[model samples]
Target: MLFRQLFDPETSTYTYLVADEGNGEAALIDPVLARVDRDRRLIEELGLTLEYAIETHLHADHVTGGGKLRELTGCQTVIPEKAPATCADRVLQDGEVLQIGEIPVRAIATWGHTDSHMAYLVNRDRVLTGDSLLIRGCGRTDFQSGDAGTLYDSISQRLFALPDETLVYPGHDYRGYTVSTIGEEKRFNPRLARRDRSDFIELMANLNLPHPQRIAEALPANAQCGCLSETP
Candidate 1:
C-alpha cells in the first residue's frame, strides 16, 4: 500500500491519500475544498488514478473537496451511510469495505463528533480517524448532534477496542503531531486514559470550545457534498 498524509494549515485538517503501489489506483480521504488542486496534481504526478473521494462525515470546520474531486477526476464521492450528504455517489455502512486496487479500506462507524461519522481502517493496519479521535484528545461533542456520552462510548467501545499496534491518523491535529499508535493513545490520552464513561462525559461537556469559524458556511455546503451548488 502507498500512503501519504497532507495537511491544511488553516484548519489543522489532515487529508490522506491511499493507493495500491501495484495497481496505482488511489483514493483521498477527508479532502478539504481549498486543497483539491494540490491533491489532484499529486495523484497525477504519482501515476495514479483517483477512484474515490471519501468523507467521514459532514464537516463543520472546512468545506470538503469531494464534489470538486468528482468533477475533476470523475471519481465517485463516498460518505458514511447516515451522513446527510445525499449527493454522495456511494454510502458505506459499518464494516463494508471499499476496494482501491489491491487495498481494502473498511469503514468503522464511530459516530459522536457528528451524528454520522466513520473511521477508515486501511489495509488492516492504520486507521484514519476523522474527527472522532485525535492525538491525545478526541473531537468535541458539542454540536452537529454531538453528545458527550455517546462519544465516550464510541471511543472506549469501538476505537479503543482496536489492536494496540494499529496506527492512528486523525482528521485534524493542532499540536503538530503527525501520528500515534493505538497503544500510545490508550495509555496516554488525557480524555480516555483511565477515565470511566461518566468522567469522560463530564470532561467533554466542560471543554467550552468555541465553534469552528466556518461552521455556518461549511455545514450547508458539506450537506451537498461540498458543492456550494456548483463545484468550485
Candidate 2:
C-alpha cells in the first residue's frame, strides 16, 4: 500500500492519494480543483494509473477536482450516496467498499458535518475522517443542513468505536497538524472530550463561526463535481 497526504493551503484542505503499490493503481480523495495539475503530476511521477476521484461530501469551502480528473485521467468520480452530486460516476453507501487495485476503501457514514458525508477507512487502519472528526476540534455544524447533535453521535458512537490505535487523517486542518490517533482525539479533542450530546450540541450552536468565503461558488460547483461551466 502507498499513501500520501496532499494539502491545499488556500482552503486548509487535505487531499489523499491512496494506492496499491503492487498494481500501481490509485485513487485521489477530496482533491481540490486548483491543485489538480499538481496531483496529476505526482500520480504520473509515481508511475500510477489514476483509477478514481472520490469526495466525502459536497464541500462549501473549495471546489472538487473530480470532474476534471475524470476528463484528464478517465478515472471515475465517486461521491457519498445522497450527496446531490448527479455527475458522480458512483455513490458509495455506508459500509460499502471500493477497491483501488488491492486496497480497500470502506465508506463509513459520518454525516452531520453535512447531511451526506462519509469517512473512508483505508485498509482497516487509518480513517480519512472528512470533517467528521478533527485533531482537537471538529467541523462547524452550522450549515449545509449540518446537525450538531447528529455529529456528536456519529463521532462518539461510530468513530470512537474504532481501535484507539487507528490513525485519523482529517479532511482539513488549520493548525498545522498532520495526523493523530483515534485514542488521542477521543481523549483530547476539546469539542468532544467529556461533553454529552446535548452539551456538544450547545457548544456547536454557539460557535458563531463565519461562513466559508467560497460557499456561494463552492456549493453549486461541488455538486456537479467541480465543473465550473455547469456551476450556477
Candidate 3:
C-alpha cells in the first residue's frame, strides 16, 4: 500500500492519496479544490491512474476537489449513501468494502459532524476520520444535523473501540498535528480523554466560533463537489 498525506495550511484540511504500489491504481480522500492541480500533478508523476475521489461528507469550509478530479480524469465519486448530494457515482454503505488495486477499504458510519458523515477504515489499521475525530479534539457538533450526545456515542462506541495501534487521519486540524494513534488520542485528546458527554457538549457550546464564512455557499456546492449550477 502507498499513501501520501497532503495538507492545506489555509484551511487546516488534509487530503490523502492511497494506492497500491504494485499496480499504480489509486484513490484520493477529502481533497481540497484549491490544491487539486498539485495533487493531480503528483498522481501523474507517480504514473498512477485515478480511480476514485472520495468525500467523507459535505464540507463547510472549502470547496471539494472530487468533481474537478472527475472532470479531469473521469474518476468516479464515492460518498456515503445518506448524503443529499446527487453527484456521487457510488453511494457507500457501512461495512461495504471497496477494492482499490486489490486493497479493501471499509466504510464506517460516523454520524456526528453531519448526519451523513462517514469514516473509511483501511486494512483495519488506518482510518480516514473525516470530522469525527481529531488529534487533540473532535469536530464541533453544532452544525447540520449534529447532536452533541450522538457525537459522544459515535466516538466512545464506534471509534474508541478500534485497536489502539490504528492510525487516524482527520479531515481538518489547525494545530500542526498531522496524525495520531487511536490509543494516543483516546488517552490524550482533551475532549475525548475525559469521557464525559456533558462536559464535551458544554465545551462545544462555549467555543463561540463564528459561523464559517463560506458555509452557506460551500455546502450546496460541496454536496455535489462544487458542481452547483450557480456561478462561482
Candidate 4:
C-alpha cells in the first residue's frame, strides 16, 4: 500500500492519497481545489493512475477538486448518497465498499456535522473522519442541517466501536496534531470523552462558533463538484 497525507494551510483541510503499489491505482479523498495541481503532480510522480475522487460530504469550507481531477485523470467522482451534491458519478450508501485497485474502502455513514456526512474506513484499520470526529473537539453542529444529538450518537456508537488501535485521520485539524487512535480519542477527547449523550449534545449546542468563512461560495461550488460558475 502507498499512502500520503497532504495538507492545505488555507482551509486547514487534509487530503489523502492512497494506492495499491502492486497495481499502481489510487484514490484521492477530500481533495481541495487549490491543491489539485500539486496532487496531480504527486500522483503522476508516484506512477499511479487516479481512479476515484471521493468526498465525505458537501463541504462548506473549501471547494473540492473532484471535478478537476475527473477532467484531468478521468477518475469517477463519489459522494454520500444523501448529500445534496448531485454531480457525483457514484452515490455510495453506508457500508458500501469502493475498491481502489486492491484496497477496499468502506463508506461508514457517520452523520453529525451534517445530515449526510460519511467517514471512510480503509482496509478496516484506519478511519478517515470528515468533520464528524476531530482530534479533541468535533465539528460544530450549528448549520447545514446539523443535529447535535445525532452527531453524538454517530461518534459514540459508530466511530467509538472501531478497534482501539484503529488510526483516525480527520478532515481538518487547526491545532497542528496530525493523527490519533480510536482509543486515545475515546479516552481523551474533550467533547466525547466519558460524556453521556446529553452532555455531548449540550457541548455542541453551546459552541456558538461562527459560520465557515467560505460557506457562501463553497456550498454552491461544492454542490456542483467544484464548478464555481454553476448556480446552486
* C-alpha RMSD in Å of predicted model 3 compared with the true structure: 1.4
Q: State the weakest 10-residue window (summed lDDT) of model 2.
A: 223-232
- TM-score of each prediction: 0.97, 0.98, 0.96, 0.98
Predicted structure 2: clash tally: 0
Give the poorly placed runs of model 4, Cα more than 4 Å off: 230-232
* TM-score winner between candidates 1 and 2: 2
Instruction: Give the per-residue lDDT of model 1 (tens digit) for 80-124.
Output: 988986899999999999999989999999988988999999999
Give me the runs in candidate 1 sitting further than 4 Å from their true place.
Answer: 229-232
Pull out the clashing pairs in model 3. none
Cα shift from native, residue 37, model 1 (Å): 0.9
| Whole-model lDDT per candidate | 0.93, 0.94, 0.88, 0.93
- The residue-by-residue lDDT of candidate 2 on 125-160, one tens digit each, is 999999999889898899999999889989999999
Task: Indicate the TM-score of model 2.
Answer: 0.98
Q: Rank the candidates by lDDT, best first.
A: 2, 4, 1, 3
- Of the two candidates 1 and 3, the one with more favorable lDDT, higher being better, is 1
